[model samples]
Target: DTAVSQTPKYLVTQMGNDKSIKCEQNLGHDTMYWYKQDSKKFLKIMFSYNNKELIINETVPNRFSPKSPDKAHLNLHINSLELGDSAVYFCASSQDPSGRPPYNEQFFGPGTRLTVL
Candidate 1:
């Protein structure tokens, strides 16, 4: 079974559109995150949710928002998508900080490729 999964593995859209990507994790992890990989292949954290609480990454733009219905799911929503938004988005999960006696590595899903024209 996949530990983490994301829908719509590829998306192509025009500028100024809105889109959302859904993600689910079956690892029973408490912390879930959304990350963006730009054209340069640099991965940046966009949002993190631990037990359904939001933990925004200050570097992320206001245009991007993340919602988690439960500890097992976190979805990313982007509004007024710009060409700069063209990138791959990854969903990940890790054990809650308190549960990490050792170290917990983040497990990433197959990314969703978003292209804005």
Candidate 2:
């Protein structure tokens, strides 16, 4: 079984269009995240949800919304999609890290590539 899964691995749309990507994980992790990988291959975290609240990176635009209906699912919604929004988005999950014991690594999905025309 796949640890993480995303629907519509590839997305193509014109500028100003709206789209949404769905993601689900069965890893039993407490934290889920949304990451964006630019054309240059630079990956950066856009949002993180730790079982309850969401932590968003300040650099991310308001047009991008990440919704976590539950601990095992995270969905991304983009409004007024622009050329700059064209990139690969990844969903990742990780258990809570323990400084007193050990650390846990994050598991990411294959990625959803969005192309804006």
Candidate 3:
């Protein structure tokens, strides 16, 4: 069984197009998150959801919106995809809001590589 799954592992498209990435987790966890890894490999948290509540990180752009259909799924929709949005999108989950330990240990999916032309 897949612990986590995302569609269109590799997305290539022209700028200004809208795109979406879907994520689901079978783990009985209360929280899920979306992270974006830039070209430099810097991982940044975009949005987090737990128990149907949305917790968005301030640095995330308005163009990105995260939707959680249920406790088990959180999907990301991007409007007017830009060249700068070309990065690896990763979906992760945690057991609780406190995170794993001193730092949150998130179980991540394979990742979605988005390319903008």
Clashes of each: 0, 0, 0
Q: What lDDT does model 3 reach?
A: 0.88
| lDDT tens per residue, model 2, 28-96 | 887888899998998898888878468545478899888888899989999999999999999888886
Model 2, residue 6: displacement in angstroms? 0.9
List, residue by residue over 1-117, the lDDT tens digit for candidate 1.
989999989999999999999999999988998999999999998888999998656588789988899999999999999999999999999887454655468899999999999
Supply the global lDDT for candidate 2.
Answer: 0.86
Q: List the residue pairs that clash in candidate 3.
A: none
Best by lDDT: 1
What TM-score fits each model?
0.93, 0.92, 0.93
**lDDT to native, each model:** 0.90, 0.86, 0.88
Off by over 4 Å in 2: 97-101
- Candidate 3, residue 103: Cα displacement in angstroms equals 9.7
Q: Is candidate 1 or candidate 3 better by lDDT?
A: 1
How many residue-pair clashes does candidate 1 contain?
0
Report lDDT (Cα) of residue 62, candidate 2. 90
Q: Each prediction's Cα RMSD?
A: 1.6, 1.8, 1.7
Residue 87 of model 3 has an lDDT of 97
lDDT by residue (1-117, candidate 3, tens digit) is: 888888879999999999999999998777899999999999998999987689656488899999998988989999999999999999988877776584476778889999999
